[model samples]
Target: MNKIFIIEDDVRIREELSTFLNRYGYESLFSINFENIIEEALKEKPSIILLDINLPYFDGYYICREIRKHSDVPIIVVTSRDSDMDELMSINLGADDFITKPYNTQILLARISSILKRVYGVSRGEILEYRGIIYNMAMSEVTFNNNSLELTKNESRILNILINNNGKIVSRDEIMKTLWQEAEFVDDNTLTVNVNRLRRKLEDLGAINYIQTKRGQGYILI
Candidate 1:
């Protein structure tokens, strides 16, 4: 799972963001020590950051600039400062994205997903490892022990979501939405077929019962 470092001083907002992100399978990390914010962030080595402008000690812009000097981690400025200048300054100081306060949480999720995809999805041979199975996303293949099986596009996506969320029960709706993000119509039966095929492929590689269905809920990767 990806770790998101939050730099908001408001305790309630920080806790809320952490809970929301956690529900979506992300690990959230934060600190109340505003004085060593930069150092703490660098040490944590988070996949991304959610920064607040109105902070104690040093503001977010300075932290963003200083962090930029050391690392290229994606930063999204989330603050109440809705002025054009705030957005522009955030961009100028190396923020990858900006969102004003009282924002829609769904939009925030989308922006974070977009930035993460852009930053991490460009590698030539990206692979996800879980429970001794290696999923080579670039080549659409899953390897276990010495056996390997090729997967179709739909099967690959379904497996990707399951493996990313690992032990969690991923809803059928969420899987369909990810598989067909731009489609006007989605067939429920199609997802079942793809998931069944993926499970069969895993079985072929000796990964028996890797995916378990939770009755009317969804599927979990065990």
Candidate 2:
């Protein structure tokens, strides 16, 4: 079952949300210690976070930004403040999605399910090994022959797609589509820059010529 962390100040709303989620087959963890909301949420490490803007000690925006610093867990802002600025701020703070107060339980559940499917629901783990390098998804780094190469988010993602596909070629467009969800946004050159950077990183880790470009085709991990 998917675990959900709820961080709403209103006891009634929190409890109701928990009960609703539980009824829909999700394990719910509520925020009790508002003073240590971030700490507790980190410890819980739910599959997704349901955060309210009107938190006690720190607003959800602050908490969301702090959480983004450590983990990429999907966060959905649940708040009664249904202003355009509030929604914009939520996105600016790295919220995966936003919902207004008096939200329909079904809609909330749908949003949660959609985000999780797009993120954690995918087949990913702490580590992925391809050829000689072990891609640590958690750390966004690849290790080869005892040497570790740290990767930027885009670099890691590009390598991961190629590695995951293995023998088959992975098109640049395909990579862009997959990464657009996590990236701030990218253009054609951004992908080229990331791939070039990834090539250098791989070479540094002794995987020279590992990622091959097929000229007009795409890239393949050999």
Candidate 3:
């Protein structure tokens, strides 16, 4: 069973989410120790995390940033802060997804399910190779010229789509729809951020010029 780590400080909300997720066959784990949340999360190593922006001691942004420094565990920022800046900051800090407070339970559940599947549902030893660069889906890392680098959930997903459609231009709309089934909830800018980040990673991995912009069409793996 996939373990979901809940990081909301509200006892009632936490309990509700835990119960709801449990009904969906997910193992829910949480800690009331708000101050040491980062430590708790890293130690537990859950499949995914539901993090609230507001907390007792350290905020979710700090916890998220700290966690990304150590692990690529998928984190969904669940908060009442629905401002564009808040969502952008969460995404910039490496959150896999974001949902506001008083959100529809079904939508939240769907987002959780989507992220978990993208992050951890790949078959063992599954990989895609293009121009000598290898993307290992199961490991969420890319190997090129004997160098290996881990990828965040979103980065890996974006790369996966590009590699599968090699030599073709994939429109932004299609990529966004594939990444988040409900594209309306996702900001158009978010996709740009993820694609740019992925491009940088690829460049660092010595796959420079592998992904090229089609100038209004979208991106293509050349």
lDDT tens digits, residues 1-222, model 2?
A: 688999998989888888977866679998679899998998988999999988788888899999999999999999999999999999998999999978655456556766766786642233566666777665677777667778999888888788779999988778888889643466678888888999998898798899888887788999
- How high is each candidate's TM-score? 0.57, 0.55, 0.55
lDDT of each: 0.88, 0.82, 0.85
Q: What is the C-alpha RMSD of each candidate to the true structure, in Å?
A: 14.6, 16.6, 15.9
Q: What is candidate 3's lDDT per residue for 1-222, written digit by digit as tens?
A: 778899998999999999987866678999998888899987898989999998999999999999999999999999999999999999999999999988756556556655765777732234566786778666688877667788998889889999889999999889998999888899988989998998888889798999888878889999
C-alpha lDDT of residue 116 in model 3: 62
Candidate 1 residue pairs that clash: none
Candidate 1 C-alpha error for residue 165, in Å: 25
- Model 3 scores what on Cα lDDT? 0.85
Off by over 4 Å in 2: 122-222
Model 1 C-alpha RMSD to native:
14.6
